[model samples]
Target: MRLHVDERHERVLALVRARGSLRVADLAEELGVSAVTLRRDVEALATQGRLRRVHGSVVWPGAAAGAAPDTAAAPAEVRDAEGVVAGMVVPTLDHPFGEIVEGARDALEARGGRLVLGLSGHAEGDAEQAGRLVAAGADGLLLTCDRAPGPDSGGWVPGTGVPAVLVERAAPPGSPGADLDHVRCDAAHGAATAVRHLASLGHHSVALVLREAADADHLRAGYAAAVEALELTPAPGSPYLAPARLPEAERIERTAEHLRALAEEHGVRAVLLHGDEFAVVLVPRLRALGVLVPEDLAIVVHGDQVASLADPPLTAIAPPERAVGEAAVALLLERIAEDRRGDRGPRRHVDLLPSLRVRASCGAVLRAAGRA
Candidate 1:
C-alpha cells in the first residue's frame, strides 16, 4: 500500500519543478499524455503539497508566488497540458483558409485539449507533416484538406496510426469515416441554398467558378445535384469548367474569360464562386466584363471579409467558423480518451454543414431582357 511517484509521473513532476510554475500542458506534450490526464496528476500533487495550483500553472514554495501564466511559460515550450487531445494544423501561416485554420486550433484548446500546428506548403508537404505528427505521438489530428498528394488510396492521412478528422470536406470515396463528428459549415448544403435563392429571384442560367482543390470536387457535386433537382440545364455550350491551380490574379482573369464565353455561348447570367477567394478576385473582372452586379449578372460566393468591403457586396455561403473550432476541440477530447484506454478504434470523420449569407452580389439579374 505504498504510494510512490510512478517513474513516468516523477519525470513529469520533476519537469514542472525544474520549470517553475509550469503549465500542466507543457508536461503533457513532453510525456505524450493528454492534457486532461496530466491535469489530474497536477491536482494530485497539489493535494499532496508537492506544489500549489494557481490559474494555469503549478508553483513551488517561494517560487516568486505571483508570476502570470503566460510569463511562466518559457519561449521554447509548446503544447498545453491538462488536455486529452492534441490538435495539429498544417500550413501554420496566413492565407485565405485562415478562418478554418484558426477554428480548428481554437476548437482543440476550448475542449481542454492541446493544439499543435505544423506548417506545410503544398500537397506533398502537408501529407508529410501529418505523418510526422503521428510518429511524434499525437493521439489525433484535425486537418483542413487531405494534404496527402497523389491518387487517393487506402493508406491515407487517417490510416496513419491516429484518429484524424477532416474539419470541412468529405472523406475520400470508399473511405469509412466515423459519423458526422465533424463540425463544419455544410458547403454543399449552403451552395444549394444559394442557388435556390437565385432561382427564386427569377434567374435560371447560373454558373459556379470554383478553385481546383480536392474539396472543391464536393462543392461541384453538390451544385450539380441542386441543378438537376431544379431541372436546369446548361444553356447550350455552357458546360462547367474545372481549372487547375492558378495564381490569384490569373484565377480571376481566367474566370472572367470563362464567364464571358459562357455568357455568350450559353447565356450564363449568374455566377457562384466555389471559394471565397474566388469571390474577391473575380468581382472586379465581372465588372470589367460590363456584367453589372444584379443588373446584367449576379454573383455568389463562399463568405469572406472582401464580401463586406467589395463594391455592391457579395452574397455568400458562410461557414460556422467559430463552431468548427469548438467542435474540433470536442472531437479531439473523445479521441484522446479512447487512446488513453488503449483502444485503437477505427478512424473518425465529421461532416459539418455551411450556411448561406445572402447579400447584394447575388441579387436578382434583370429577367426582362434575358427572358425575352
Candidate 2:
C-alpha cells in the first residue's frame, strides 16, 4: 500500500499536536469518537511513524517542544455525514428533545441525508403521526420516546419496513417483535450524580420532580438505586411513578407548590427535577413562594438547556444530546445498508454516558459553607 494515513489517524495526530498532550478520555470527548476508536487510530498513526503514542498523549515526531502544533483537516465523510435525510419524523421537539432533534437533523444533513420531521401534540396522537411519517417514505425514523405516556405506547415503530431508531430512551420492555435500534443517554448515571451532588451539599432530603408516569421499569429501578447509593431515603410516602396526566401551566404551578409543601413536611433541603418543563416552571414559582434557590432550598434540574438558563440559571445534569443524535444516525445508517444487503443487522442498544455542567441557579458552594 502507498504510504498514507486515514482521516482518523490524522485527527488523533492533530489533536495531540494542538493540546501538547491529551489523555485518551479527553481526546475521545473532544473528537466525538469512542476511546476504542481513538486508540486504534493512535496505534495506526504511531505505526506510520507520524506520531509517538505515550500513555495517553501523542507527540510530534522529532519535535523538541510539544506546543504550537499544526492543524489537520477532519475527514470529509466524518464532517459531512453529520445531518439526516429530509422528512424524518422527530416526535416531541420540545426543550431537551427538541435540541436533540435539531442536532440530529444537522448531523444527517452533514452526511447528505434529509430529515422529515413530525410532531405529536399528545401521547394519544403519537401513533398516528408515526404512521403518517412512515407512509410518507421517511428513510428512517428518529423518535424521542422517553416522555411517552406509557411503556406500552404503540405506533413508535410502524410496519413501514424501514429502520427505526429510538433516540434518548431504551426499548420498552416485553412488547416488541420489531427490530428497533436504541440509542439513549445514561440517565441512571445522571440521576445518581444529581443525588450525590445534593448529598455533598449537605442536603439530607430531596425530591425528584418527574413529568409522566414511567412505563419503563428500568427508570424506576435506576431511581431506587440512586437513592440507595446516595445513602438517602426516598421521600417518605412519595409516589415512585410519574404524573398520569399531561401538565398544564397552572397544574405545573400547583405541582411546585405541592412539592414545596412536601419538602417542608419531609425536611427536604433540595429538589432535583427530572422533567425539564417542571424545572422551568418551578424556578420562578419557587422564588415567588420565597424559597430562595440554593439558599433556603437547592435545585438540580436534569436534562439540558431549558434548565441550564431558567431564570436565575439552574445547576443541571446535561446528557451528551448531540452525541446521542450522532450515534443514533450512525446506527440507522448501518441498519439501512444492511437492509440493502438483504441482511438484517444484529439487535443492539447504544447507551451514551452523561456529564454534569454546573451553573449558577443551584447553590453557591460558598453559601452552603457559610451556613455550615
Candidate 3:
C-alpha cells in the first residue's frame, strides 16, 4: 500500500524536509500538482506529525521558534481531472486590453479554474508578476507580453517551469518559439487590410499616424509592404511615429495641427490613426482646425476600442482581444493537464486575424468591408 501511494506525496515530504519549511504553493508548483492534491497530502502528513502547519506556513518537525510560515492549502480539484490555477498579467484593466482579462477570466471559470490577475503597465513589470504567480503556485501562466522572445532568445521559458501561453503577442512562425502555445491577432494583416480599404477609396496621398508601441514595428512593415503591393505612394514622412502616447492635451493639439498641415501642404487625403481613442480625441481637434473628416481627410483607427462611442463612429481594425484571451486560457489549461501527467509533447501556437469594423469614420456604405 505504501509503494502504491502516489509518488508525489513522498516528494512533497522530502521537499518540506529539505527546505526546513516550504510553502504549500511552492511545493505544488515544484510537484506540478494541483492545490487540492497538496491539501490532501498536507492533511495526511499532519496526521502523522511528520510536519507541523504554522498559520498557513509549513514547519519541519522540531523547527526552532520563528520558523518560516507558508501559504494556506489551495482548494482541491472539484472533479477527477486536475484543476488549474492560472495567473494572467496584462498592461492595464482599462480599455483595449482590459476585455482580454475579462475573456480569460470567463474561460477559466467555465473550465472550473481560477485566475490570478496582475498589471505591469506594458512589459515594465512582467518578469516580477511572473515570479509572484509562480510563487503563488499557479499551475499555468497566461501572459500578455509587449514582445515575445524569439527562438534564439530562449522563448519565454519561465524559470518556474510553469507552462506559458501568450495572449496578444507575436513570435516568429515555425521557430522553436512555436513550441510555446500562443494566441494573437495578425497585426500586419490588420494594417494592410485597412490600407487597402483606404486605397480602394481613391485616396492616393495616404499617411499613417501611429503612437510608438511594441507593435509599431509590425505595423510599419505591413504599411510599407501594402503601399508597394498596391502601387500607392506614401506621402513624404508618411508614417508619423511618435515615441509615446500623446500624454498632455497640448501634445495632442500639436499633433493635430501638424497633421492638418501635412494634409493641406502635402495633399495627404487619408490617415490611419494608431487606435480609436486617439481618433476620438483628434477628430474634434481636426474639426477645430476646419478639417472635415471623410470630406477633407478620411480617417481609420487601428483598434476598435470604444470606436462606436466616438461622435462620428470610427472605422477600426478590431484586435481579437477577447478571442485571443479565451483561446490562451484554453491552451494553457490543456498544457497544464498534459504537464501534470508528464506528457511533454509538441507545442501549439495560434494567430488570429483582425476584422475591420467600418462606420461613419471611414465613410463606408455598409458596416464592414464585405457588405454588399
Best by lDDT: 3
- Candidate 3, residues 161-269, lDDT tens digits: the string is 8888878775566654455677887888888988999988787767887776667767878788898999997777868865464565866787788788978888887
Sorted by lDDT (best first), the order is: 3, 2, 1
Worst 10 residues of 2 by lDDT: 66-75
What TM-score does each of the candidates earn?
0.65, 0.66, 0.70
Candidate 3 clashing pairs? 36-76, 56-70, 57-70
RMSD per candidate (Å) reads 13.7, 10.3, 15.6
- Cα-based lDDT for every prediction: 0.62, 0.64, 0.73
Sorted by TM-score (best first), the order is: 3, 2, 1
Backbone clash tally (model 2): 25
Candidate 2 lDDT, 285-352, residue by residue in tens: 77888777766668777677677657667787787877787677667766666665677747777888
Q: Model 1, stretches more than 4 Å misplaced?
A: 1-81, 122-128, 134-137, 146-161, 175-184, 236-239, 242-251, 264-266, 342-349, 364-372
True lDDT of residue 171, candidate 1: 46
